[model samples]
Target: MPKNSIKQDENINNISNKDLLIRLFSYLKPYKLRVFLILILLIYVMLCGLLNPYLMKIAIDKYISSKNLQGLILLAIAMFILNFLSMIASKTSIQMLSKVTNKILLKIRQQLYEHIQKLSFSFFDNRPVGKILARVIGDVNSLQELFSTSLTSFIPEILTLICVTFIMFYMNFVLALMAIIVIPFLSITLFSIETISRKRWQNYRRKRSNLNAYTHEDFSGIKIIQGFSEEEKTSRSFLVLTKDMMDSFVKAVRLNDSFWPIVTLSSGVGTILVFFYGISLLKSNRITIGTMVAFIAYISMFWRPIINISNFYNTLITNFAAGERIFEILDIKPDITTIKNDIMPKITGTVEFKDLTFSYNNDATILNKLNFKIYPGETVALVGPTGSGKTTIVNLISRFYDPTKGSVLIDNINIKYVNLESLRSQMGIMLQDTFLFSSTIMENIRYGKLDATDEEVIAASKSANAHAFIMNLENSYNTEVNERGSRLSVGQRQLISFARALLANPRILILDEATSNIDTHTEKLVQSGIQKLLTGRTSFVIAHRLSTIRNADRIMVIDKGNIAESGTHKELMKLKGLYYDLFMSQYKFLD
Candidate 1:
C-alpha cells in the first residue's frame, strides 16, 4: 500500500450531497409505494393547516360578528374535527415512514456487508475494521433522521408554505408581499450558517469514527498492552483522541446555536411587520377586524414553515454527507472476484505454484517467480526469516489473493478458474492467532461445518487433542466463549481451532505457525494431534521451530521470497544449505 492510502483519514469529500442523494434515493426505489403514501398523508396534513386560519376567519366574521351563538358552536366543532383528522394522518404517516426507513437501512447494510465480504484481503489489511463498521452501521444510522423526520416534515412544511402564501395573497396582496420580503434575507442567512455547520459536523463525524476505531483497537489488544505495562500510554492516547472528537462536536453544536437565534430574531421581525402594518389597515377600515385577526394568524403560520424549510435543508445536508460516507464503502469494487465461468473441479490435493509473481501493490513484489509443488498426502514445511513471504505463499494457495502473474493450480486446474467457495471449502487453515466468535465451544467448533453433528464434533475434537481439556471444564462443550474467545487460554483457543479445522474435514490442511505461541506441553499435544490429522491430506506447515518440520515428507527453506533450499531433514543436512544451517542452529535445543 502507498503511504497516501496508509493514512487513516482519506478524503471523503469526493462525493457530493447531490450524488449521495441520488444513490440513497435509488435504494428507496423498492419502497416507492410506501413513500408515495406517506407523501399523500403529508399533503393532507398541510391542507388541514391551510384550512385552520380560514376556519378561524369564518368563526370571527360569520359567527362572532353576526352574534349567532349556534354558528360559533358549530364552527368550533368543525375546527376540532379538522385537527383530529390531521392528528390521525400525522400519526399514520410517522408509523409508515419508520417502517420504510428501517427497510431502506437494512438494504444498505446488507449491500455493505456483501461488498466487504467480497473485498480482497489486501483491502482489509489496509483498512481498519472499526472504520468499515462506522460506514456500515454508524453512518447508515445517520440517514434515519433524514428518511423518518426530514421526509415527512419537509414535504408538508414546503406545501404548507406554498398554500399559506396563496391564501394570504388572496386575502390581501400588499400586506402579504410586505411580510414575505424578510424570506430572502432569512434564507440567505440560514443557508450560509447551515453550510458551515454541516462541514464542521462532517469533520466531527470523521473524528467520531476515528475514536471508535481507536477504542475497538485498544480493547481488542488490551491484554497485550496490560502485559507490557503500556496501559497508561494507551489510555493517554485514547484521551487525546476523545478530547479532539469532543472539540469537533462542540464546534458543530456552537455553529448550530448561532444560527437558531438568528432565525428566531428574523421570524420575530417578520411577525412585528405583519402586526404593525395590518393594524394600520384596520384603523383605515380598509379590511374587516376579523380579516386583520386571521391575517395575523397566517403570518405566524407562514414563517414557521419557512423556518422549517431552512431547518430541513440543514438536516438534508448533514444526512447527505453521512449517505456519502456509506456509499463510499458500498462503491468499493473488489479487486479480486471469482471468474463468472468458474466451477469446482475434482482434486487429489496435489498443489502447484507455477512461476507465481505476487505483490500487495503494483510497484513492489512480495513473491518473485515462486515455483513449488506438493504431492498428494505429503506434509510440506516452509521455513523462512520474517518478511520472506512465507505467509504470502499460504495466502496464494487459499486464493485470498490472485497472483499478479502465472498461476496457482490444484489437481492441474488453475485455482482462478475454480469457484472461490469450492476452493476454500476443500482447505482448512489455522493461523497462529486463532479467533473464536461469541458462542458455545460446540458452536465454535460447528462453525467450521455448520451442519456437523455432535458425534462428529466430539470425534474431531478428540483428533485435535482438545476433547480431554474441554471435558475437564464445568460445562464441557457447552462452555461459553466470550467475544474472540478471550475467556479461554491461548493453548485452549488453539485446541478448539484445531478441532474446528478437523471437523471441517478438508482435503488440504494449512497450519500457519500454529504452535508459535503455546506452552511446550500444549505444543507437544497440538503437534501430536496434527500428526494424526495430517494422515490422508496434503498439508502445508509454516513454522519457525525446526523440530516441528524435521519429520515432514519435504521441507523448503525460503529466502528473500524465493526457495533457497529443499529436501527432507536428513537430505538437507547432508547438503548443508540454508536449511542445514538453520536446523543445526536449533538442533541442540530440540534435543
Candidate 2:
C-alpha cells in the first residue's frame, strides 16, 4: 500500500458536507448564466410533473364523474401537451449540463497540470509518475457525474419532492403525516450507511490508485523484468495489487448497492401506511374519493424523489472521494517559485558557488558549504566517484534547486533572485539519459530554438557530428524519432541531443555524462566536434572516462560533499591521490 493517503494527511471528519458542497458548487458559478437557464427549464419540467397527479384527481372528481366526454377529451389533451413540453425541457437541460460539466473538468485539468509544472523537483522525487497520472486522469473523471446530475437529476428531483410534499399536505395533512412516517427511520439508516460508505469508497479509490501505480511501474520496467527472467515474480506482484483493488471495490460497491434496496423497502412501507390511512379518511367522509386517489398518486411521486435523492447522495459521496484527491493536488504550493524574481540579463560566462549547500528531501548533505568560481571561456571538468555531487553542481547552476545555506551566482548576481527561465535559458545541459519526443529529427533539433532556421539546425548538427548519420537515414532529417527515439541507436540519440544543445548556442554549457551511452568509436568520432563546440564557452564536462577531459583547463575531483583535488590532468596524476586512483582503475584493463 502507498504511504500517502487523505486520511493520513487530513482528518476528513473536519470537512463538513456543507463546506464540500459549497466548494464543489463554486465551479458552477463560472457558467452561471447557462446554469440558471437550465434550472428554469428543470423547474418547468418539475411543475409539469407536479401537475399530472392533480389532473388525474380532476378527471376523477369533475370531468369523468359527470360523463362529460368533451371535458374529458380536453383534459387529456392538456395533460399530453404538458408532458410533451416537459420532455423537451428535460432534454434541453441535459444537453446544456453536458457542455457545462465538460468545460469545468477541462478548466480543472488545466489548473492541475499547470500547478504540477511549477512544483520543484523535490516534490516529484517523493512521488511516482503513475500516482500523479491517476489523480489527473481517473480521479478527475469521477467528478463528471456530480456535475451532470447536479443539474439534470439532483436539482430537478429535489424540487419535485418539495412540490409534491407541499401538495400532499395541502390535500390532507393527517394522511400526509401517515404517508411519510417511515422517513425518519430511513434517514437515520442512510446517515449511518453514508458515513461508513464514504470511508470504504475512499479506501477503494486509494487501492485503485495503488493498482494503477504498480501496473504503470511494471510496464515501464518490463525490460528489466524480462532480462532477469522475473516474469513470474512480476506477475505475482501484479496479482497481489489487483486482488487488493478488487477486494476494496467489492466492499464499497456492496455497501453502495444496498442503498437502492433500502430505499425501495422504505417506499413500499410508506405507500402501505398511506393506503390504510386514506381508507379511514374516505370512510369517515373527511375527504372525497378524488382527493384520496390524488393522495396515493402524490405518495408515489414524493417517495420516488426521495429514492432519487438517496441515489444522488451516493454519487455525491463518491465524487467527494475524487474531489478530495483533486483538491489535495491543487492545494499544494510549489516549493520553488518565480515569485518576485528578477530576470537575469545576458552575462559573461563566469559561474560561482557561494557557501552553497543542499540535500535531497533534507537528507545527509550532498554538497557542503563549499565555494568555487569558474571564469569566462574556461573548460572545466568535474570527475568524481558515484554519488559525489557532480550532477547537483550543474543542477544548482541551472536553478533547478535552491541552495540550502547560500546561493549560486552567475556573473556575481545570485541566481536565487533570478527568474528560473531566464537563468536556465542561458545554459545548455545534456543529461546522461537522453529523452526524445515523438517528432521528426528536424523538429527535435529545432526544439532547442523554436524559431531557428533550417540552416541553423543543419549547422548545429554538423558541429555535433550528428548530420552524417541523420542524412544517411531513409528520410534524412524528416525521419521520425519514434517513442523516446527507440528506433535510433543510443549513439544516434545522444548525437541528436548534442545537436539540440549546440543549436541553443548557450554561453555556459554543461555536458553531464553526455557521451556515456556512445561506444568508444562513436565517442572518438565526436571528440573534435565536442572541442569545437566548447571553444570560447564556459563549459563543465562531467565524465567517468578520464581521456575525454584530458585537455580541460581544470579538473575538480569531488569527494564526500567537497572537492578533494583540483588541478590539470598532469597535476592530479602527479599528486597520486583519489583522482590518480580513479584514473588508473578506469584504464588498467585497457592497455
Candidate 3:
C-alpha cells in the first residue's frame, strides 16, 4: 500500500465535547448583540407562556365558578392578546437568530477553507479530496441546526423548566416534589444513552465521509471504469460502501429515537404523580379547584421543556462530533510555515541541492545524499529509468516537499528561509497531467499572472503556439474550457498550460514529461515554443523523448537517486553511459 494510504488509517485525536463546544461557540462572539436581543425576546415569550396558565387559574376560581361572566370575558381577551404578542416575539427572534446562524456558518466555512489552503502538500497527500470536501461542506453544515436552536429552543426550554419548577413549588411544595421525583431517573437514563449514542454517531459520520470519498473517486474515474467494462463491479463496490453508511446511520438513529420514548414515559409518570397528589390536596381543601387545574397545566409545561431539553442535548452531541472532525483539521499546524522575518527577494535561478535526502514518512528513501548545481540560464535534461526520483528532484526545487535532510538553495540563499510566495512566484512548473479550471481560455492563461492584460495574454498564447487553435474555437480566447479542461484535447490542454507558464515569465522552469502525451505534430509546435521560453531561464526537463533534450546545454542521467552521468548530449553519447543507452533504445531507427 502507498505511504499516504497507511497514514490515512491512523486515527485523529479525540477531542472532548466541552472543548469542541467552546471552539464552536467562539464563532458566535462577533454576533453577541444579535444573540443578546434574541435572548431578551425568548425570555419575553417565556413570560407570555407562563401567564396563560396563571390567567386560566384566575378565570376558573374568580369568574367561572362564581358565574362572573364579565370577568371571564375580560380574562379571555387578555389571553388572546398575550398569545399574539408571544407569536410576534417568537417570529422576531427567529429572524434575528437565523441571520446570526448564517453568518457564523459563513465564517466557519471561510476559516476552514483558508486553513486548508495554508496547509502543506503532505496534509492533502494523506487525505482524499472528497473527505476534505465532506468536512468543509457537509460537517460544517451539520452545525446549522444546532446554532439555530441554541437560542430559539435551547435557551427558552431551559428557562421554561426553571420557571415552571419555581412556580410549581410556589403553588404547593408537596405536589411539586411528587412531579419531579421521576426526573433523576430520566436523567440517568439519558446520560447512559448519550454515552452510547455519541460513539454511534461518530461511527456514522466516519462512514458518511468514507462513502462520499468513494463516490467522488468513482465519478472522477468513471471513464476508466466504462472503458474497462467494469461498471457492474464498480457499482457493487459503491453498493457496499453505501450499505455500510446506512447501517451506521440506522444504529445511531435507533439510539437517538429511543431517547424520545424514554422522555415521554418519564413525562407520563410525572403527570400521573402530580395528578393523584393534587387530588388528595384538593380533598383536604388545602388547594382550590383552580389551583389544582393550574398545577396540572404547569406539570405539562414542565415535562414538555424536559423533552425539548433532552432533544437539544442529543442534537448537541451529534453536532459536537462534527465539530471535533472540523477542529481536527484546524488543529493541525501546517508542516510548512514561513519564518516570521523571512526575506522576499528576486531569484536569479542558480539552483543547488546540497547533500539532500528525502523520504515519505521515514519509509524507504526516494533520494539519497545528492549534491548538484545548475547555473543561471542553463537548460539541463534529466533522463532516467522509471522511479529514478526524477519528479522528486523537481518537486524539491519548487519546495513542494522539503528535503528530509540537507537543504535546497537558490541564488546562495536557502529556499526554506525565503518567503514561499516570493520563491514560488519566480518558478514555473508544468506537469504531464495539465489541470485547467472551468473558465474561458483567456482566464485560464491569465491564471499564471493574475494582473496580466488581454494583450499580454494574447502574446503569451501566440508564443506558446496556442493562439491559432484558440482563435479557431467557437469564442476564440473567450471559449469556456469545461471542468479540468475536459472540453479540450490532451494536446490542446498541454499547450494552454505552456501558455500559462510562459506568461508567468519565471526565472526557473521545471517541465516533467510535459509534452510526453502530445502527438508528433503538436510536440513540434510546443517544442519550438518551449525553446523560446527556456532562453534565459534555468530549466529542468524530464522527458522520454530523447530528440527534445539533444540540444540541452547539459544532460544528466540520474540512477538510483544519484547522478550516473553528466555532460552535454554529444559528450554523454561519446561516453556511451546510461544516457547513450536510453537514447539508442528510443531512436535507434534514426541512426
Candidate 4:
C-alpha cells in the first residue's frame, strides 16, 4: 500500500452512530417545511393503505356475508378511489423529496468546498491533491444516498412500522404476536450484519480514496512517467490498488445483499406462524374469517416497513464512512485565520526579520535565528544553494508560515499582527513554478487585479514581453490556456504569470526565479520593464544567474540557514567571500 493510504487509514477516527446521525440529520433543518409536507403526504398514503385491509374486513363480514351487494360495490369503489389518490400523493411526494435531497447535497458540497478553501497551506502540504479532491468531490457525492434515503425512505419506514404494529395488536393480540414472532430474531440478525458490514464499507471507502490519490498523482506526472518509460511500473501499481478496492467493495456488498434475504425469509416464517395459529383461532370461534383474512394483509404490511427500514439501515451503514470523512475535514480549524482580521496596515514595504527561526515538520531547521533588514524600495537579491532557505526567506516575508520563533515586520509593524489580506494584498510574490487556471489569457491576467481593463492587461503583458506571443495566438487574449497553462510554452506561461503579478502592482514584489524559463532574448527584452516595475517598490528576487542578480542593489548569499554574505555584486566580488565564490561559480558557466 502507498504510504499515503497508511496515513489515511491512521487518520480515521471512529465517529459514533449518535454523533453521525445528529450531524447528517442537521442538514435537513433548512428544508424542514418541505420535509413536513412530505411527511403529510406519506402519512396520507399510509392511512389509505391501512384503510385497504380494514375495508376488505368490512366487505367480508358486514356486506358480502350479509349478501348486501350494493354496499359491497360502494366499498369496492371507495377502495379504488383511495388507492388512486394514494398513488398521486406518493408520486408528488417523491418528486418533491428528489428536489429537496439534491438541494441538500449542493449545500453540503458548497460548505465542504468553502471549508477546504479556508484551510492553511500546512493542510495541503501534508495531504496529496488527489486525496483532497476525493474528499471534496467523491466523498461529498457518496452522501447523496444518506440524504435521499434518510428523508424519503428512513423516516416514513419507521412511521409505517409503528402504525402497522399498533393496528396488528389492536385487531387480535394473540394473532399479532404470531404475526411478529420472528421480528426479534430478525432484528438481531440484521444488527449483526450491519455491525460487520460497517467496518467493511469503511475499509472500501479508504481503499477507493487510496486509488483516487494514486490515479491523480499518476496522471498529474504522466509527462515524467512517459519520459522515464515507467508506464508498466505505474500500471502494476494501479492494478494492486484496484484489486484492493475491489476486494473491499465485494465484501461490503455481499454482506449488504444478505440483509434483504434474511428479512424476506423472516417475513415468510412470520406469515406461516400467523396462518397456522389463526386456523386454530378459527376452529375455536375466537376470531372471524374476515378478521383472519385481514390479519394476513396486516402481516404483509408489517414486514414491508421492516424490509424498507433494513434497506435504509444498509444504506446508512455503507455511507456512514463517507459522512465521517466529510465531517473530519469540516471539523478542522485552520492553522491560520484566512478571514480579514481587525488589524489592517498600510504597507510601504520595509521588511525586517528579527531572530528568525523556522523548521518544517518540526524536523531540521531551515532558518536558524537569523536577523536582517531591507529598506523601503531596496532590491534585495537572494542567492543560495538548494535547501539554503532562499524560498523560505520570501515565504516568511509573505507570512505563508508563522515563524517557529521570531517575528517578521512589514513597515516595522509585526506582520503577524496585520490582517492577512492587508499584508498579502500589498505584496506580490511569484514562485519559480508558475500556475494558471483553466481560463482565457485575459481572465488569467485579470486575476491579479480583478477590475483591470483590457488595455491595462495588454500593458502588463507588454511590460512582461508576453504581448508579442499572445497576439499571435488563435483567440489572442481570449484563447483558453487550459489547466496550469499546459498549452502555452514554458516561457509564455511564466511571462503571463509575470503579467499577472505586474498587474497587481504591489508595494513589495518578490520574484523567485521569475525569468528562469524565458529565453535570453525575452529576458533581455523585459529587463528594462522589470526595472521600472521594481522601481520605488521593495523587491526580493531569488535567482541563480549572475546576469539576473548582478544589477540588484544588495545581494544576500544565504547558506546554512543564515546570511553568509551581503553586498553589491562588485563589492561582494571584492570581498572574496561566499558571495564571490557563488558569483565565480555562475560566471564560470560561460557560453
Q: What are the per-model C-alpha RMSD values against the true structure?
A: 2.2, 2.4, 1.9, 2.0
lDDT of 2: 0.86
| Of 1 and 4, the candidate ranking higher by TM-score | 4
lDDT of 3 by residue, 1-591 (tens): 122231132245678878777888888899888899999999999998888889999998999999999989988998998899889999999899888999999999999999999888788887888788889999999999888877777888999999999999999998999999998999999999989998888888888888788788888888899999999998887788788889988999998999889999988988888888778888889999999888888988998888888878989877777888889888888877765537657777798999999987677898999999999999999989988888889988988888999999898888888788888888888876799999999999999999999999999999888899999999999999988998999889988998999999999998988787778887888788899999998999999788989899998888988899999989999999888889898887766
Off by over 4 Å in 1: 1-8, 362-364, 517-528
Q: Residue by residue across 1-591, what tens digits does model 4's lDDT show?
A: 112442254267779999999998898899899999998998899889888889999999999999999999999998999899999999999899889888988998999999988777777887777777888899888888777777667788788888888998999888788878888899899888888998998899888888888899899899999999999999999999899999999999999999988999999998988889889989999999999888899898899888888888998999999999899889988876634365656678788999999987687999999999999889999998989999999988887788899988887887776678777888776789899999999999999899999999999999988999999999999999998898999999999999999999999998999999989999999898889999999999999876887889999999999998998999988999888887777778763
- Superposition error at 568 for model 3 (Å): 1.0
Q: What is the lDDT of residue 361 in candidate 2?
A: 71
Clashes of each: 0, 0, 0, 0
lDDT rank order:
4, 3, 2, 1
What would you estimate as the lDDT of candidate 3? 0.87
TM-score of 1: 0.94
Task: State the RMSD for candidate 2.
Answer: 2.4
| Global CA lDDT computed for model 1 | 0.83
Q: Candidate 2, 490: how far from true, in Å? A: 1.6
lDDT of each: 0.83, 0.86, 0.87, 0.88
> Please, what are the lDDT tens digits per residue for candidate 1 over residues 343-395?
76646889999999988877578889989889999999999788898888888
